[model samples]
Target: MQIVFVGGSTGQGGSPRLYRDELSGDFIVQGYLVTDPSDLAQMKIPDGESVVRVPRSLFDYLPKDDADGVA
Candidate 1:
């Protein structure tokens, strides 16, 4: 089953919203995960992968948009 992982920006009281829904009752999260070792290098961003921790209260305020994805 798919799951939603919501996160926030670098600051400014914002958060990232992830959608987790199984349209066909076979939604998988791991299957959708894509790994690109050169992602940061190509984007010219930090190369180090870091973990982000968020409080439950902040997560409750995360926005939820059910709009279609841009593919």
Candidate 2:
């Protein structure tokens, strides 16, 4: 269950970060919780699932290839 840093946003006051699960090859994102009622109303969120908002630039650091076989 080890997680490694993938990237992060440089926003002031708040930071949105991304992480990768080493064993499961899954992505974990840390960002502001979506609390806007109007925004949440548009999506059918399940009981166990939620959403967060992050800067698009955060994805720029994502690995472009699976050369490391971590994918």
Candidate 3:
């Protein structure tokens, strides 16, 4: 699936980056749970159904429009 980095900064170094699937529009971080967007070079397409540890703070940086039910 095609992935796009929705927000956040790649320069943060070890800071986790958010990625969105261009096809499914599903947000993913560290692989498992669908979450948000990323930098191209440093990103890896998530595989399998195993959940990985992700930084909760990354959610705050996602675009408000991407939320499931804010309206």
For this target, which candidate reaches the highest lDDT against the unseen true structure? 2
Any idea what lDDT model 3 has? 0.59
* lDDT by residue (tens digit), candidate 1, 1-71: 45544333335434333333535322212212224656433544445643333345544433445344311
TM-score to true structure, per model: 0.24, 0.82, 0.51
Per-candidate local distance difference test: 0.38, 0.82, 0.59
Which candidate gets the maximum TM-score versus the true structure?
2
Model 1 regions more than 4 Å off:
1-47, 65-71
Name the lDDT value of residue 27 in candidate 3: 77
Question: What order do you get sorting by TM-score, best first?
Answer: 2, 3, 1
lDDT of 2 by residue, 1-71 (tens): 88998777665525688889988888888888999999999999999999898888888878877876354
Off by over 4 Å in 3: 8-15, 31-48, 66-71
Judged by lDDT against the true structure, how good is candidate 1? 0.38
Point out the higher-scoring one by lDDT: 1 or 3. 3
lDDT of 1 at 58: 45
